[model samples]
Target: MSEIPGLRSAAGEQQGRQIPPASLARLTIYLRALNSLLAEGIERVSSDELAEAAGVNSPMLRKDLSYLGSYGTRGVGYDVQYLNSQISTALGLSQDWRVAIVGAGNLGRALAGYSGFQSRGFEVVALFDADQLIVGTEVGWLRVSPVQDLATVLGRTRANMAVLAVPAGVAQSLCDELVDAGITSILSFAPVVLQIPDHVQLRKVDMATELQILAYHAQRAQDPDLESGPRARAAQ
Candidate 1:
């Protein structure tokens, strides 16, 4: 596989170097901050200001932006539009990615109708369901197809990624089918650990886990003494 073009400076050329995942995540956050700044007609921004906008420290933001080969001009700071373009290209947002949603349930339906995906270069080309009842039904502009037609639909639509929103029990099996169908990237909403091939990129979003985490913080805020309780120590 070829190295990502934007991962290196034009002069530095660190093609063989590995980028830390944390840095990559921060780059996306930086990209979002740039987008908001651009929309507000903000032109040039210093590293400290950008870091404040992104809710991260200035040094870390600089470090993350450095990995994208974009070091702001000394004294003048970064050009907002140019920095945004650099980050976009670095994150592969310069190209449109056709996506497929597996499972025609509630979560799948919501994701399918989300307009934000289209603006960000994610085009949902196909929706699939194992249940025959929803196979021919419409989810937006596209009609739902049978899961059995995954490979054919993927090839026909040229979809490179898929979103798995099915039940935990069927997520792995459906994931296997997606991989077999040549869909390499997947964003899973199933609250379970899915086994995927090393070649395929898989990301999981557990809503329940996030809510539970929030609940824990809320509990701590409500009762400061809870952290000192015997039950908390025993559990820990």
Candidate 2:
């Protein structure tokens, strides 16, 4: 909530424009809260109430919202519908984005079958895998194609984004292939760090990392003083 003094820099400012990651992430929370408000037929919301619903502080929420321009009223707060639209527009969710899934394993198959993608303006157009046994197989309404056919599928489907669900060892190769195939965005599930171009956007979802985080919480729950010596060993 502290003032971001250099936020609104001059046109010729030497410093790079930096928007806080927390502020950017809060847009998603705002969208969800606004959606809930819309479902409940609520038209307007105060900063304090919206922040509480989004599990964030009011000043922080106000500062984040300010980056999108002045949409809040002096006393009445913000118009729920308008604010929702603004956030969606800022996140580039106003239009449908085509997505392809590489590696048609259980995780990939599940992603291809997920209904949430459609609701979020992401359409799964193709599924790819190197395994011949799984290739040509049907997953939901889409057919799994050979990994060699990735370029062809990308060209045919015009997908700008791809989801990599391959194993850790093969994830890098798959990512390279996707980049070569003109994919600008990648959502990888494997537990490997990828080398990608500056123009490419890579998002990783490591289940192992999530499990480790959960394990940490579980360990702490078993022994609150786990940070110290004997307690930590006991917690483990």
Candidate 3:
């Protein structure tokens, strides 16, 4: 387990920092690629091979891995298992993360049923909903708890992380409750922006925004104006 320099928590755990946001995101992709290779019993992988698996260029992948001070040998390539462990440690995947999801809607239920969360160290300990009819319903092993008991349930389940799958209108109130109950990390799917205290870390996943971006790219790809550029003009 190679330790990442200058990346440590107050408790001296391997914490992630200094890496740029884009590089950090790529590290996760690389970790996923490495895990797949490990599953296939691949002992070593060259930069080009790993890059292709991760959908990144060789030079870009090497640059991202450089943040962890991991530069493979010139010809021997990288040890797959070793590199996987290093990235896992750097991303703090070794720690147990218990998640409480607010809103027992379709999305929440789907998220709770995702087995990948457990495989990645996040345990979905609790599910919550504002509706009385939805409460007491089972999503996986978890019985949907009422949102009214949000704070109490969070404390009882010892959930340090939360997912907000509620509507934008009520997202803020639920977010405040989660923060008050000592949840410092939150992943919100609400279409509205949430304001939180400096201590809390909030990550919003706006599906609408992503869809709009995709729409933009799709439109551009089909544009006749783009086809009229140098290559098409030369063909004519």
Best by TM-score: 3
Runs of candidate 1 exceeding 4 Å displacement: 1-12, 226-236
Q: Kindly indicate the candidate among 2 and 3 with the higher lDDT.
A: 3
Q: Estimate the overall C-alpha local distance difference test score of candidate 1.
A: 0.85
Model 3: lDDT equals 0.86
Per-residue lDDT of candidate 3, residues 73-162 (tens digit):
665788887788778877778788899999999999999999889877899999999999999988889999999899899989999999
RMSD of each: 5.9, 6.4, 5.1
Candidate 3, residue 88: Cα displacement in angstroms equals 0.4
Q: List the candidate numbers ranked by lDDT, top first.
A: 3, 1, 2
Point out the higher-scoring one by TM-score: 1 or 2: 1
> Lowest summed-lDDT stretch of 10 residues in model 2?
1-10
Say which prediction, candidate 1 or candidate 3, comes out ahead on TM-score: 3
Top-scoring candidate (lDDT): 3
* Residue 93 error, candidate 1, Å: 2.0
Q: Which stretches of candidate 3 lie over 4 Å from their true place?
A: 1-17, 226-236
Local lDDT at 68 for model 1: 61
